[model samples]
Target chain A: MSLTILGCHSATPRTSAHPTSQYLEINNKRFLIDCGEGTQVQLRKYKIKFSNINHIFISHLHGDHFFGLIGLISTFGLLNRKNDLHIYAPTGLKEIIQLQLKTSNSWPQFDIIYHELKNDQSELIFDDNKVEVYTVPLTHRVYTNGFLFKEKIGERKLNINAIKENPEIEICDYQNLKNGKDFVTKNGTIIENKELTFDPNKPLSYAFCSDTVYKPEIATIIKNVDLLYHESTFLKDRQEIAATTKHSTAEEAGKIAKKANSKQLILGHFSSRYTNLDLFKQEAETVFDNVVLAKEGKIITVDNKTFATELTINQ
Target chain B: MSLTILGCHSATPRTSAHPTSQYLEINNKRFLIDCGEGTQVQLRKYKIKFSNINHIFISHLHGDHFFGLIGLISTFGLLNRKNDLHIYAPTGLKEIIQLQLKTSNSWPQFDIIYHELKNDQSELIFDDNKVEVYTVPLTHRVYTNGFLFKEKIGERKLNINAIKENPEIEICDYQNLKNGKDFVTKNGTIIENKELTFDPNKPLSYAFCSDTVYKPEIATIIKNVDLLYHESTFLKDRQEIAATTKHSTAEEAGKIAKKANSKQLILGHFSSRYTNLDLFKQEAETVFDNVVLAKEGKIITVDNKTFATELTINQ
Candidate 1:
């Protein structure tokens, strides 16, 4: 699984800093998260294929989070998109989008499905054989949600050397071995399933938590996650301001990461007032050892084994 | 009067090209025209003071023409703008903007007055002591209107040398002299009004006509204008496509400029498919002698006396 940070600033979009938006690729599915204004331009600048985005997840209705959605949708129509598109967002987004299309008298050729979110509790939002997605309710001035993506466990791997030594094991029995089943010979001789096959790589998971104050309950729900992305709007010195604005400080993000026992922590959604971002890392490092700033155009990958985190620059 | 081109491209916005948006400063009033996506960034890049903008004119409800409006309004709120903002657009835009604000639960502290336009003929939309703005009805796929900004005829300039030569002209009558009233000497000698003062600047005018087709009727409405900006979405080779799309070609823009007897013509809103824009200028210069391309970040100034257009780059 891989995650790409498109924008990571709070409040306003500037030439140097953009609002919040990210791209996630997991289980052969591409998902766009929180399309801030100018997101379509960012997607083009980062060289991401516009057609690859099939689903969009909006955390809230703030202009900084979801303003670019309609423009992206309109561009898709101009580009003649034929596939269906799905939007998972808070309630009231449907009316905004529908009204825009109605006034312009231009509708997309593709089907648009809106999954309005209104619940305040964590619930499974999407599920397929390969992956599952759940919402992480957040505490904010507005109704907001974070998404958790988990990879489903796969079939067991075949032990090629062990099967080769046992000539009695026919090719037709390979399927059962992969399914963790024991092999039986014609004379009632049995071979243990563990001896015939090795265990598959452990399933990996990533939780995206942002735009919320210091809520320890979120940490409890996302315990022992592979990777965690949290909003660090300010440093420790501005904790009071963070509380008043319903935002989190860097120390708060670090506390959540440590409590969740995540292998890696990515801090993002910085406040525009703080130009000296080194203080954020210094404060977060006090509680969490492994922390990385979510810079725009940076990609983070989660490996299959042990959920190791890898960072790379885009282009 | 000065006009700045923030973005002047048709359809989708790109890294090199922007969508339709322009800034017009006429008679000391700042006006924003056609706020396409990324317009706020363009305004920032051009260093145009965002707070100085009091009026916004949207040509139509198309995404390219007005998608950046909500983001701009939201940013004004974040910046703590206290002045009233007036939006001149179609009737459907109020619902779209109001719904977005309602869903986010973020209403601006400043007053927002919306002037809904549904006129099909040329009508005066804004009139003050110093300037008058009229809508230029155009033919397009959507309901679109162009704007004509006219600097009102000012008080006649006081000829200090002539006033000094006339001993009978009293200091208390300076206002009357500036108002172009003839002076009668005590000896009953009548002095002509032209001898006392010169005419003010000839009332410079600028017409912004875009996102429309090649209609000859537009020339009659904007006759003898100082500067004219017309959409040149295609060249003569693609005139058929321009006709089908209700867009104007560079040659058509030149024809309109020639018919209106405009002193200068500026062509913009080029399609993204065309990278080399030399053909646009060549096609336009065929009918009109003075023509300029509306390059992004390029400032076009409409001078007073000669109605000459000057182009300069934004610092």
Candidate 2:
């Protein structure tokens, strides 16, 4: 799975800085997460195909997280898109979008299916043959959720060498062999499935945690994930403000990542007050070594076995 | 008065081009008109003082015209603005903003006074000693109104050269002279007010007409303004589409400017399909000689006498 950061700043969008938004491409599906204002422009700037965004996930109702949604829907109408778009967000988003459309007297040519999230516990929101998406309920100033995207185990690979050793193994038996079935040769010789095929790549997973306060229980739900993205809105020095605002500091995010035992941690949603982002990484590193700052336009690739080398922590 | 084009393109915002939004500074008051999706960034890019804007005028409920409003309002709350904000828009905007704020469970520290327009005729929406803003109702798919900003005639200027001629004029009489009152000297000689002072720079005015079809009646409401900005969403070739979309072609906008006898005409809201904007200028110039394309970030200065030399239209 590859994750692209479209925006990461907290609070509001500035001329050079953007708010929270990301694009994830995994299992042949394109997912847009937390569309802030100017998200369409950022998508265009990053050259992501607008039509390819089939699903949009909003973490909360904050303007910084979902203000750009209505415009994107309107733009889709203008583009005459016919594919159905699914929005998994808080219950109130549908009302907001419908009201805007009602006032404008324009409706989208495509159908918008709203999957309203209301529960405050981990629930499987989306599941397919290749992946499953679950919500990680988070503590915030308002109702919020972080999503965990986990790839499902695929069909076992075919062992061509083992198959070549069996003369009675026909092409029709290849399917059964790949499904973890042992082959019995014509002369009563047995071939083990493990010796035939290597294990498929370990099921890769990525968890997105943002706009939430420091909650250790979240780490338990997202433990041992290949990659973890957590919001670090402030440094340790501003922990009081962070606590009052229900936002996490860099050190807090780091502690969560370390407790979860995630392979890699991405720190994002930095407050606009700080110009240098390296401080976030440094603060996070005090608790967790594998921490990367989520910069706008940066792309991180997560594989099943390890984090991609291209996006390794700078340190 | 000075008008700054934040975003002028019609319909949806693109990567390099923005939608409809403008900043008008008149009589020491800053006004934001038609805030599109990326207007906040545009404001930051142009370095306009965010706190100076106390009034926002939204033409209609179209996404491209007013989607940026909530974000802007939320940003104001984030900045802890204390001044009350006045929003002049259609009746439904209040509910939309309130719903989003309610869902987020956050209210602005400042008060939002909404002046909901439900009329279909010209009406004075705002009035003060220095300036008066009137709504010019226009025909569109949705309820839309253009704005006419007229500077109130100021106190007569005290011509220093002419005042010096009267040696008996006391400092206390200066206020009376500036207020256009004749000063009676101690010898019972009447010092004519006209002789002592010249008229203050003739009251300047500007009119913003956008997102409307080719309607001639609007010209009557905004007649003879110093500067007029009209939406020209299409070229002459796409006049049929413009008519169907309730938008104006370049020639249609030019005709409106010509009929209104505006001192200067600015054509904006060009469709995104056409990248070469010179054709819009060419089509508009065919009917109106004083025509300038509304390029983003271009500031137009309007005085009582004529348009400023800095923004002189190329012949």
What C-alpha lDDT values do all the predictions have? Answer: 0.91, 0.90
Q: Which stretches of model 1 miss by more than 4 angstroms? A: A168-175, B168-172, B186-189
Scored by DockQ, the top model is 2
Please write out the lDDT profile of model 2 over residues A30-62, one tens digit for every residue.
799999999998998888899899899999999
Instruction: Tell me the lDDT of model 1 at B307.
Output: 65
**Residue lDDT tens for model 2, B152-230:** 9888988888778888887888899888899888889997899999988888888999889999998888888889999
Deviation in Å, model 2, residue A101 alpha carbon: 1.2
Q: For candidate 1, what is the DockQ-based docking class?
A: high
For all candidates listed, what's the TM-score of chain B alone?
0.96, 0.97
Shift of residue A228 alpha carbon in model 2, Å: 0.3
Candidate 2 stretches greater than 4 Å from native: A305-307, A312-315, B312-315
